[model samples]
Target chain A: MPSDSHEIVTQVYAAKKDNKAADSFIEAYMPFIRSETAKFTGRQPSQSDDELSIAMFAFYEAIRSYSRFKGAFLKYASVNIKRRLIDNSRRERRKLGVVSLDQPAGDNEGSSVLSEIIEDKGRPYDELEEREAVHQELAELTERLSVLGITLSDAAENSPHQKRTLEACRKAVDFARSEPGIIEDFLRTRRIPLSAIAQATGESRKTLERHRRYLAVVLLIFSGGFETIQEHIIQTLKGGAER
Target chain B: MRYIVAECHPAYAILLDENAELVYAANLHYSVGQTVESPVLMETEKTSGNRSAIMHTVRRAAATAAACLLIFGAYRLYMGSADRSAGSTIFMSANASVCMEINNKGEVISVKALNENGEALLSGYSYKGKDKATVSDELVELSISYGYISSGDTVSFYIDAPESGVYDSYRTELLGRLGSYPINTDIQKYDSSVQVRSDFTVSTQATSAQPETAANSTQSYSSMTETAETPAADTEAVTNSTVSTPADEQQAESAYPYHDPETYTGQSGEGNENWHGSGDHGYWYEESTDEEENESSTSEDTDQPYNRRHDWSDGYGRYGQDDDDEDICQYSEDDCDTSSESSWNSWFTGWSGYRFYSYCEREEVSECGGTDICTYDTGRDSYFSCEHGTECVQPDDTTDETEETEKTENMDETE
Candidate 1:
């Protein structure tokens, strides 16, 4: 019930995503980022005033790329701050026994060195993606889903949406399982047809028509994607026969 | 990897290869990594807990990754939400990203990024650069979703009048207010942007809107406030629980055979968390019954009330259900948008603390469609991450509805 920050964050972001303007935005928000970063105090290296500076750069980039797809800018920016902070900590630890030197009042060593190091490390533009980590995260997620007695097949087979679309569909399926009347109530209350579901789910109507046959076994399967699985089986069997 | 004794550690410890020339032999310290033998070892100390812990962490991560690949034979899968409307109008929603900065000057500010639980996502690393320092690990990967007419509206309703002109320009705005994460003590701010590329088939009647203020507010309030309005759902729930008359029994009979709809009468889940145990269907294109079972399984947990139908009572439709009573200022005119605009949107953007925004310059240039179209239409529990904490790497207390209500009440009393 919190007042939505989505509008403000999204608007500010959309209004200034240009790479050319990234610097000005970064400069204006530098103070705010410094303040937010400063809140970390003892946790960060002692000799680092550049914390705000680094966080600002990240914030600027975040401003450029934030979107409705991620929910709200507040939520997204908070995540960004944490990420930048962690990297800063890691880099500082790698330095001399200073592990991480907290910047003394007048010492400029921290910022200069940090800037030099950051510049050396280069842009992580494409490195942001860790295929291995993502894969691991996915496996862990599906494993958790499995604990509920639902297999990936039982979940994803329900709808043939895109990979991301499949993720959304799975959430819907997961929610449906926890609620008692969602399935019947959804159809009756919203007047949404089983076929119309293809929009969110990219499943074919023909596939849906075929799978509507077993509305009971789904309980045994513990997932909503039985129809999709059935269609797969049918296709496989036909293919096997053809071979 | 050459061994060199650097400044931090005393005696013969490992020295950074690059810094060797500068600190080469400031003291009698030998290079850090090469030879384990050194006089400094005579007064050595015990290994610290910090080093061991970091090593353990690396080991655990490697093990987990290996185990995952062995067992599941697949990688991580990120699910996206479809309860979208922000991109219904302007700017192409190309992508969404989470970014951070790194430099020596930046390390001091890293702590604020941690979730209340104290976990860091974009941790950093060090390397040398040319002209300027550029931190790498602090990544910001964008979630770029292109909204194309996946499938046109099949059940088309006739546009009453001379609604002409193709949809050449459109913009969308999204303001999420689902409150904090598991570790976030304070409410985390979520930023959302939406862009849609449309090929609008046009009709002739110039689309016009009839702005009715009082009625519009009430109607908008009812529609926008419907999901957030706790009373409506609570009343339905109460009606459902008390309906035990003979007529009610007959009504139950008239209700769904699979689900006793009338037994609960008008009992709609208002403040309750909406769950995977849906009232109707899950994402499966067809009803395979298994999906129904899954739905029933998750529905029994009472912890989540807003899972089914969330009440926007926390705040109005302005931005969210709480705190923001003053609606977001409406900026429907083009002239107002020309001032100081960011580089992303075309200087024509505005936000008044809530969840609404307007892009077109002139009010008369294009009549607002259904000027009073104020209903929030997407299922509250539309994603997997919300229900089982699947994709939530870190969560917060306000992430749930029960705590939000308690907090809201506490704040109200204080005020």
Candidate 2:
């Protein structure tokens, strides 16, 4: 039992970094994923089933995100698979009509029905382009964070849990944005000027130091022309303040 | 909360929300850059490790403090109540009876009246902040002022303590205070080791013994007065006449001598036995005979004239006059011996005014000098002169001595 658990943890850690390892890990947990989908749907799901595909995707996501802190990998994967299947079912219910998008164009031979899609004001294409732009912005932010010896996971982990501490971090970010030199200094030194931020914003040095990596990520996103990421953080801060 | 698929993976996709923050979501046949609304997102643990640890420590500390406060509060309540209910108990009985609950520090915790008279005696009295001795002194004074106890009446104290030494100390302190009053007091001790009887009735024996002592002393004084008035009277016949006389006037005279302090020690010592004996007339008579001997010894030590006055005036002269008034006549007898001792002290203490007042009053002399000096002192060049002749003449010395000696012999015979 211990060896099996050790193997599962080892596979999940490997799968987080390697796409092939993640694919193989999903294939190995296919039976477990099917069982979780079966529990949610209350019936056996075939290979072609959409719920089965969603559960498989959820299992793969669990592998990518699994850490020792989250406890037994199988239990975590089972919960993720069940939740994903429920979400998919709910989303499917909200659709007004289901279109295949692969339907044949009646007038043109060898043309799919997707070619006739003009009504919806090109929303899907625009959404797709917007998604690509967001992806570019995120990739840029990820690259900048890596330069500061921080991962996206580390930033998520070190983010302040308490509202007061989060407000203090935001204040320090605001101060850095106001004084461009501080942001330049951070980028040059690759270090958060905790004492200067503490003095300028009246936030304690300890708070800035404790959340130094998260502050660095926010500051870099703001200074490095990552407008998509910056707007996302501003919206989140506004929503938190409203709450 | 819509998300656009930013990057697609075989297992999960990095999706960007409208806010542009990247999130991990399950990929369901999604191509790269495909916009997806309401995607199934990964659930990350909300609380950080450090925050959870701080919360756990804070919870444990709060629980510990609550437990400690509960225990301490319960203990304080228990001890406070324990102090109130624990300690020595004292039952004081004059004509009125009261039971005092005292703490270890000798403070009076409560004073409960045992009967109607006791309730009346303690009415409007506050015992708060007063120690046992002070409370006792005040209670005895109240007993007198309220007429629950007066000249020669007995006040009895029953003390029950956690130890014999405690009982002894209470007995001594109480007796000492009560001795100052012109009344008799008796003390009985009980060790706390013995289970105290729940029934708080003053013992029948103790109650009966006090009156018996008072009656014996009253009877002796009557006999002595009879001997002084009629020198030819038979001693046994005179002793038997005790039951016929009104003893209030003589009892009042007996109370006066208590102004002398020397007699207080002897009276207190005698108070111990007054409650010890069974209420047997024979026992009391024997005790009175002992008192007579002590008196005779005192008379021998003092001057002849003073002895004659003491022997005549301090006897049960008023006992015969107040026969119907048993309260005054009965208890008057207890002070006869003390009166003999007081006569000696009163002379040096210049209590001559009190002596003359008692003398003139008892004799019913209408024109006895200024109501302060008896007409008997007119023959001597003393503190006061009288216009009236010395109506109180000395009885023939030989005859008076013969009568006293005979009375002593008869009392001894009776014993």
Candidate 3:
């Protein structure tokens, strides 16, 4: 009996000359292509998906270029396929932005653009009912923030104005996200856990204390039950205000 | 870790600009159930002001988008349509040298010789759709033509290598020719081994022959052919024989060293049933059967264990007797020294190989007239009566010995 390498060599040589053989080689590895694409995309890729097509083309390209010196065929093919899918996704992201701020807030009849929702300053009176609802939500948020001795005025005063300071404050919020114990402790004790935040973030304790109120508001939104304001705060922190 | 907890008012904005001014507008401290008007300026502020601000922002954004679209549309109109030649496809042979550009209706647009010498050879020939000719040089031959496949407007270039040029040159030339067109091109290169004068006449014939000839020339073709011809039958037979041979051979070898000559001959005869390398074991079985028949005819030979064992040995010899004896002996010294020796071997053997050993042993004992004795050999207890077919104890003799002991005890007590 011929070894596995021998069999593959024959199939590859046949594939180079015959269209049917080349197609059969592709058809045989279709499941493998789908699995690799799914691994990269984090979801099962379907036949109609552009990612699947890119993976299949990468597999074909691998077959054309493969030699015995390249080692195992599937290993080489898998690496090539994954790299191609990643490159394709990056290119697609550049050409067609994956996350669009233009999407409507919801299926509700009066739902406005996400950009408007994130920038809450100029809400139209037609959305006054929604604004009234947000007013009550803000009252609740104020009650929550007061647990950390942070008032609305404190947050306004503590809000970072310079881009560098905003970035540093954003990093602190990100640190708080990864370490939820700090948020829980702050809520339970009614004070910012500055040392814990510093330890987790490797930031100076003073820096965390200075941005305590701003971080408190960010953390409260992240703590859940405040979707609209959370989206706005997150976008603003990501420099969406300048955009 | 802080022990001190303080109560503080959370009724205020944290991130908004001038949030302290906005907090007085919150009006959360209003007296419950009060009929008085609240002093919240932001809430009571007219909605017209907010609406105007929103309208101004929306209008500005719309104007910006319109301006971007206008610029993009203008750029597309000015510079985009220059490179697009509608429905024109290019076809080149295996080498990039010989090229033919065809229009939408399968009409030849231009034929170019990319190589140095072939420029003059293919130039002035107006092969425009009527370009059906075999241009041959000292090295190779070119058959170029315009034709139709199911996918419309195919330019088939059959490269015929008559004397001496590499297939790569022709193929590279064909690829280069197709690469120049800004349209979807299908360039099919016929096998270089076959020499055809024109693509129009022999396109179908050469295309069909390519796969077969390519299959024949492959280095692994013989192995592939073997795999293809009797795929099902050969796979099954090969796999079964390959799997079973090593196991059976090991058993035969393991039995060979320790068994008595007569028992070894019997065991090997049955163990090697699947082993066809030797002379027919069928003939061996027949000769042994004749001897057994003659021996059994002599009814006076009841003492011979082989005579009593032959009936049960037929089944046991094939599967178990030879193999299980070693296991039973191994278990006897270590485990059978305990009180439950016999049952432990039975349990161990039952769980291991010989799932049917228990049933076979019971049947064999019964078929030996139910008087077949269980002899305790110090080497290995008689797990099977005819494993050696030599030593066995009758069940009636053991019963007699127990009765004698009972009688002796009664006599002593009476005295």
Candidate 4:
């Protein structure tokens, strides 16, 4: 199995420079690609399935661009396969005349589809609601950030660049979540409880101060009713922990 | 290089790149599933960028100022200590003695008077902003104006500095400045090992006399008196002479007439014996004789009574006139023809105890022909007016008569 993984990494590397190697590498990862598509489609992807074909194209694209910096070749190919399948689903939804969940539903002037619709078990609708919730949460976060003289762009720039520093920031967010007083103070003052976070998490005051804006945004997402935004951060942090 | 728009929001879009990484970029009105290159990603805010740039510039400026302060502080520390120990001290002596402390640049920092005459000489003088040479020249000019120095008198300089080069430079500069003056200039390096005598006693009577000539006459008389009295007693007399004479007088005596009798006596009590027995006596005697001659010649030209008294005393002591006290008194009466009555009386008053008695005996036996009886009476009264009390009269008693004869015999043998 190790040899197979090693062979896949070598093939992906060669494929980055040559198209024939990309095709060959994509063919080799067909099972992994179908499995990723199956996870999205909830079934085996037949050869005629356009999702299957899209997943294959995504795997080929992954091979054409893959480098050692991208981590395991199989995991990278799987992510590309899933992304392409999602893109295909959105493209089909567009064909079905659904512009965006954020847009008003059926000529309703001030109401979004997400506000008007009931909860549905349909995958597209569920995805639409999740995206709509994320968009709403992001809008709410943007407004709250502006009150603190911060912008989403400033939050992104002030975000810790190093993985360890990012983890430290996540730890600060978790500490703020556990300590209700910290969240209340942060909400009332619209400022990060920098010294409190540093003292509780054993992180340096300098590091916390450097990422104060980003920490404020993340703590707001955790402490407020911004569930969708908070989930995004949790997923990313989980991914980081897994790595 | 290519990203497919997976999800679009009001603020940003989640774009799926070929690397499978989801990136948040600014939404430029893009539809989902649209493949695009060069989408507007969320860039750093203009305010944050400007703030960072300003902060960077502030940090750099603070660092530069700190470096400049550190360099300046270190420079001040180094220069402060260097300035503390960098100066030279100049000791200038005529009859007036002044000490000038100078900096490395030769500028006088302070002037201190070493005697009362020096204080009078420097009363109206200011050394501010003047260099060593300028200050020395001004001081010399002041001494001349105060009559502390004359055409034939010597103005001696002693320089104490951190380096010999400083001494030499100061000497050269002072010589160049005072070379045109009529007075003689004597410059020498000062040895700190030799203890400087600050308490210099000058007689008001001889203030106008040449300091070197008067000092030589006094030192010769003091040494002769010391030798005539006791060899061990010479130390106290030499110390008294050293303390009473001006600094230049002591220096001249040390350089020519006498080697520091204190140092010689400190080595052993036989200092007087070594002083006379050593070949140094002839050179010293010759130098003293030459000084007396020069003093006599200048006295005739200048009409100084102090110089004539010095000549009389110097000749009396050196020619061993104590052997025939009667003939010496006759000679003093004959010399009174050339000097004023008061000067002659004052000269007689300055005589030693033995000579005072011999002069009294001469006045009793001989008629005061060339000299008046009042002159004799004045000398007798002045001699007895000293605070010595009965000690002044003890020399005439029988107990001290043997001691006086012994001193007279010692004086004859030394001559």
Candidate 5:
């Protein structure tokens, strides 16, 4: 199996050199071409879409010309597909005036060819009901912790209460999030490695060991995935001083 | 992360297969074999088309050139006619029977005589003068002293043609050539008592060179006295009078003979008598009118202190001396008010204003600190222990605030 981009590109070039092999290679990548064209055209492209044809031709051209020095063959092919589709769009725009979506359909009365429907995605409501979002995130966190034989409630119970202790735990969590290898190890093993955290944060091992599960949960929130819950918690921590 | 990355490839494969069905595979395959044409080569091909259109452009250029030449020729003809219209007047003398063309500048363009002798002498000659003439030939200069005279103010040579016969007939033939404009018959003669008098004056001027220097020296002396005793502004006017040439002073003296300088201090009734006694001489007529007006206006001020002294100096030398006492008094009051409030300062500054010292010069001598310094500090500085005293600082703040208030008031007044 090809491991690197260079091996993949070399194989594609070799396949294009043979007429029979080139046909199979182009046919195999045809779905990939249609998907990239759809990404730009904002819908599933059909046989009638000129952008699909342009993207396919660009992919075929890329297979013929791509070299190992250019890095990834898929990336090179995607770039060519995008560029050709844009060029076709510009050409069509000059040749034919843009048809507005609001134009009424002749065959159907009281119906536009393209409807003006707005999709909200409920993002603002998520921020407004921040408590519900945090509770939802905590449920997901409990499920993730269940695999490690630890519950979300146990992590919360172990959380530092005194201001100085909480600050020390936050320093260890921040260190683990910044150092990707530590976070990756924690995620893979479902455990906080106390020695690494203590060495990095200069906190005593016993203190970090005691708060390790809480630090692990905080690290998970900071790293990725839990964006809304993380923002709410940071705001809470900042307001904690007033309390 | 590994699962997400793995899923992207499968998703891409599905997208490509979906789009590949939309593309006409045969068309895509054909296009893949073809190469794109170079943009540089296409540009060169476009330039080749420009060569084929060159002959069509040449015909257009030739047509435009012909039109430009036609317009230029018409403009030249219009300008030529305008020049001819400028110098086209001809005057004919009724009695002399001589016709001549005179351009706007009064130069003789051409001369034609009706009588034989006049015709013979003036056939090729041109005279260019108001009251002077020149007679010459193609070969030699005949006379430099030859002259012509015209009637009234502007000269035109309808008479005084070059020949001896033209000179003899000038009084009789050209007496009425001036047309309804009454001209003295004596002026028609080709003779000159006036010119002789002018020549005598020139000769006398050449002979009396020493008196010119003596008059100039006296003028310089008078200007120095004016600078020392009167305001500096008066010295400029006095210097201008003193610097006049001896001929100018002679003209002044001849125009208005010496009158009692005191007569100018009275009303216009008395002043007009002296002006008329001078016969209102030609150059001084305007000066006499101005003097008459001055006397009438300043008659009321005759009793004012220092008024007679100022008026006496003005009357003694400069014939048309300006009245400067009012300006002197105004400047004196301004200096006293701005620099000091003391009675001593007021009296001394009032006299100093007329003594030919500029405000800046007097300011330097008397230590008059300008608008910036407080007047209260002038005589009181020696009495106070501190150099400027609190009076100086307090008034500066008051003065600045008042200045701002005054500026706003002035802006309001303008609006």
Candidate 6:
């Protein structure tokens, strides 16, 4: 209603500030995440409802961590969508015979692996929530990594989605940094369909459905990687996209 | 998706899905064997851009890159056939030449007197005589024209300028007076001292300005028969290539000056030290008494010239002072002891509104000195000069008595 959508976003941002209430806000917005990720769904062979769940949690993360000053929550949410999609694609490629994670992949396999994406659902909801929690813990554990001559950026980059996916996921976590409840309100007003939101936000639907593995992590120091609210927090996104 | 020659320009082309639904094609480039891999559709919508294929021989992949580079003001010139014909004179003079000339990181080779009358003329770098090279860095080579270079009916090689400068001499042979054929290139690795020089005067039109008095056509430039008096400017004069400045053009220009001179005093012997203003613009010095002295004494093929053309160059010695005197630029009371362009006749007097040094330049200068010393030149002029460096003022051309009497009027001779 204001000159920019950023104006409406500011409200949701205000609500997300209370980390205690971030879960409802995230749940209400999971549909948006589902729809956004759905666009990239067919592109990955391993893409499934489960991946949607992880992306949903990621969306919750975007909601919880989003800041109004960063513009519309959607803009910040876009990066989260891409991260979940790519992470899921990369994981699926490795799980299937399509791509070998340990091998030095030549350029030839890049296209072939790209073609093999999106044949199955993403990781299950329970498994993703556990993984998300461990990641959160791992992020906290990594603070001492610098003592081992490991840089946060370097280690993060070498991890799952490399530094890029970590950054994407991290962005979603910071979504609630500003006004908190704006995402929930936005989803309610728009009546964001979970699947539609999932596809758009790139959060996993499974992660969206089982939304509290991370919601209880409020007492956990918002330390680096505690998927504290991962279930209640984030999800892998699904969508059909061009490589 | 395949491309045709007509709309192959890539801006406008209609694309359709197998279902005949219109697919918006933002941009695309396809050659004879080009392959366009389809996107993988959703399990529910499994048909858009879905394919498992390999492709080959793409000149470039950015269906949008060409347009993007175009936005960046860069373009590609796909070389064509017909370069073998010696007399073929293709290309217009309004634009930078692409086919004939070449440049390295530091130096630009002016192709002023190329004779296309011979078989090697058209084959400057394209395969006929040389092999195409692949470089890991950005490369640029432009030819101005193809003809002969000579001032009159005779192509002349003029000698001027200092040593550490870019070229030793600027010349163009004129058996035929080539219009303007300059080879301009951006050197990814610009090392001033190590740039390659072509001093040989074979039937080759391109030659360095390293003075060659009695060298034969076959004489190697490295084995100098005789070094010219001044460090000759070895600029290859291409047909009609002027490399002129834009008075104040906002358009994009080369960072290198080729033959542009910048004096230490910072005025333009030809122009100002555009090192900051524009890359092509070099530091310059104006004419005044001290400039007269240096021009008279130095035969070292003119070290970086304090410009003769710019009056202010000589007046301030381009540093806004004089060449003969030794004074640095002026700053605030706390910064320096003096002010700049305070002279009655200086351009800064009327236009500058009030005397305030360009803060950027003022910040870098050392503290000012006491007893501002005004010195004389070969021509004997005087003005307020600093202790370590001389001020940029002209020598009093008048006789000694007149100079003394004039000093008496201002009560300041700076003796």
What TM-score is obtained for chain B in each of the predicted models?
Answer: 0.12, 0.34, 0.16, 0.38, 0.20, 0.16
Candidate ordering by TM-score (highest first): 2, 4, 6, 1, 3, 5
Best by DockQ: 2
Tell me each candidate's TM-score: 0.21, 0.39, 0.20, 0.29, 0.18, 0.22
Global local distance difference test of model 1:
0.28
Candidate 2 lDDT by residue in tens digits, A81-200: 777777788788878487666677566786658646635556766766766776787678778788778866556445554455667887888789889999999889887788888998
Q: For residues B214-282, what per-residue lDDT tens digits would candidate 5 score against the true structure?
A: 222222222121111212343223323433333564686576443332354332222532222111110
Docking class of 2: incorrect
* Residue A182 lDDT in candidate 6: 32
Top candidate on TM-score is: 2
lDDT of 4 at B60: 38
**How well is each residue in B161-265 modelled by candidate 1, as lDDT tens digits?**
111221111000011111111111111121121111211111111011111122212222222211111123332233234323234546644563222222321
Q: What is the C-alpha local distance difference test score of each model?
A: 0.28, 0.55, 0.41, 0.52, 0.39, 0.30
Q: What does DockQ give for each predicted structure?
A: 0.01, 0.11, 0.02, 0.01, 0.01, 0.01
Clashing pairs in 4: none
| Candidate 1 C-alpha lDDT tens digits along A8-29 | 5424443343333444555555
TM-score of chain A of each: 0.33, 0.65, 0.43, 0.49, 0.44, 0.35
In model 6, which runs have C-alpha deviations exceeding 4 angstroms? A1-4, A12-16, A37-52, A64-72, A75-79, A89-243, B1-415
Tens-place lDDT per residue, model 4, A130-181, is 7666556666767877888876545554555334566777777778878999
Ranking by lDDT: 2, 4, 3, 5, 6, 1
Better of 2 and 6 by lDDT: 2
- Interface Cα RMSD in Å, per prediction: 25.2, 35.8, 36.5, 39.0, 36.5, 27.2
Better of 1 and 2 by lDDT: 2
Please write out the lDDT profile of model 5 over residues A1-243, one tens digit for every residue.
222343354357455444446557777787888899999999999865656766766776576545443568888889978876786778667857766556775566866455354444557655446545544665576577677666443453355543445666767766776789888888888778788888888776765666666676677766577665555456544434322
Candidate 4 lDDT, B1-415, residue by residue in tens: 5665655543345554433234555455666655568654432222234554465456435544553465467558645533432256677865777666566567775665655676677776677778888989888888898888889887778776656776777888888999999989888876533323343322322222122222232433221211111113332333234322234445655554433323544321224331222211110111224443333222221132222221111112331222222231323544332222212212212223212111211111223212212122222212211111111223344755775566445435544
Worst lDDT window (10 residues) for model 2 chain B? Answer: B276-285
Error of 1 at A138 (Å): 36
Question: Where does the lowest 10-residue lDDT sum fall in candidate 5 chain B?
Answer: B1-10
